[model samples]
Target chain A: MSDPAPQVPPQLAAYRATIDNLDAALIHLLAERFRCTRQVGRLKADLHLPPSDPAREEQQVARLRALAEEAGLDPVFAEKFFTFIVAEVIRHHEAIRDELSE
Target chain B: MSDPAPQVPPQLAAYRATIDNLDAALIHLLAERFRCTRQVGRLKADLHLPPSDPAREEQQVARLRALAEEAGLDPVFAEKFFTFIVAEVIRHHEAIRDELSE
Candidate 1:
């Protein structure tokens, strides 16, 4: 039997490699972003600020959705993706604050 | 000006809708899972357990990677995806413990 056709083009191999590299870079960037978020949590904790800031999260979701659409990604998928990230960040911030207290 | 071609096929529209519904359900399930993780965190905190259980996390990553592969997803992507989720769950658990303390 003949082998199945290739899903991706040979010419696109380089592009696919670039995407993989970018994905790795994105992980590093996300880690850095989490580090900054930890700092923000520290500040918030110091000021006794509430951990869940709905307004700020909404604004962030809107901004990221727009950016993703501009970058030619599905906006709905981007929104869901960032929602998970933001939720995680907020949780991390809360955890940091908890650690600082003890 | 010519209209742009449809990107998704009509037959796939129902499938896409099902995916969207599943996505929403997945969010709900995740939230429920977080709730359970929070309870686990509370128990851990009561028992004076450390938040970072590297061994358990490693096992989780391995198991999920296998499951994702079985589900026909890119194992690497699934690993990264679950890493994010696990991190978030830990953070949430910590947060829940913090709140319980106050």
Candidate 2:
């Protein structure tokens, strides 16, 4: 009798490829979002407004959680994601402020 | 013969608890950092400066990458972490500006 050959599942490979593409798309969208946010920051500077608004951040997190849930994502995970983003925005804002002050 | 009892290593449990505590500290520090950043944002807005500084962001990323490597972390992963944070800061700055405009 001939030895049997090892077989790999094609479906799993296709699913992985699809996930890779989705990840690329996600990164592209995130970049675009950052660009728009930068423009908004410039506008705020022009208008003499502060960078971090707790109330606004709270609203944003709440809204994003709802949107994530609607899109079939875990709300808790979404909240953690937003928390990380919020921390970064505050850091960038501070850097700009320090530069201008100097 | 009696069935053998399942067992979890106490060391593994202790390690997990330590990791959990570290995560909590990381969150707390991040929050404090954001608070400082927000203060910086306000200072910048008062001085009529923009929210996003590409040069500064690049410098910060470079510094962070080096620090991460020194601490036995993957530089690429550290960069991704910083990228996410930068995006959030820009978004928060924009929101602040929009509020002031209104």
Candidate 3:
């Protein structure tokens, strides 16, 4: 059982249209980010380097926290979000390393 | 005790620069998204509409999942990311509604 949607006012619709476009843009940006990270993973594997770089990750966290504060967003949330993405990237990097070893 | 930073090869340095730019862009986009959502919260409060809309969220989940697949990203990860942002937006909306009621 689902309730029917209420009549969306025009202003709300316009805002949503903009939001949708921004969401699409965000996804594309993320895709590009992962693409770059994947290349890094391959390079690291070829070089016999570790999959994760803690120093670089720490630097990124600090840089992004500052950027988040500048953008009027919560630094903690930004850090959490970045951590989430980094975890995924590391997983991919580890997988790449394992594939190279096999 | 921390590992020393590696001498980054030029190719890796280039990739990191691109990743940093994309991360900054992502943060700005999210800031804009939250800005728009906050306005939506205020308007919903004015209209006495509910803070959370499950039906719309479900629709959005489906839409973004499809978009993620099209972008060659993991749909599950995309859904999880969207769900994370939506949770924050709902919390903001609830706060707005409470403020209006007071």
> Top model by DockQ, which number?
3
DockQ of 2: 0.02
Candidate 2: what is its chain A TM-score?
0.80
Give the TM-score comparing model 2 with the true structure, all chains together: 0.48
Per residue, candidate 3 scores C-alpha lDDT tens digits across A1-102 of 776756788998898898899999998888889989999999999988888888889999999999999998888889989988998899999999999899
Clashing pairs in 2: A88-B85, A88-B89, A89-B88, A89-B89
Clashing pairs in 3: none
- TM-scores, each model vs. reference: 0.46, 0.48, 0.91
Q: Give per-residue CA lDDT, model 3, range B40-84, as digits (tens).
A: 999999988888889888888898889889998888989988988
- Per-prediction fnat: 0.00, 0.00, 0.65
lDDT of 2 by residue, A1-102 (tens): 775743423543353344334333334333444444454455455555576667656766676666655654446656776676557556666666666667
Candidate 2 error regions (>4 Å)? A1-102, B1-8
Q: What tens digits encode model 1's per-residue C-alpha lDDT throughout A29-96? A: 34444445555667667767676677655765676566555554445655767676667657766787
Rank by DockQ, highest first: 3, 1, 2
TM-score of 3: 0.91
Residue A42 lDDT, candidate 2, scale 0-100? 51
Error of 2 at A4 (Å): 71
Candidate 2 residue-wise lDDT at A29: 35
| lDDT scores in order | 0.56, 0.54, 0.91
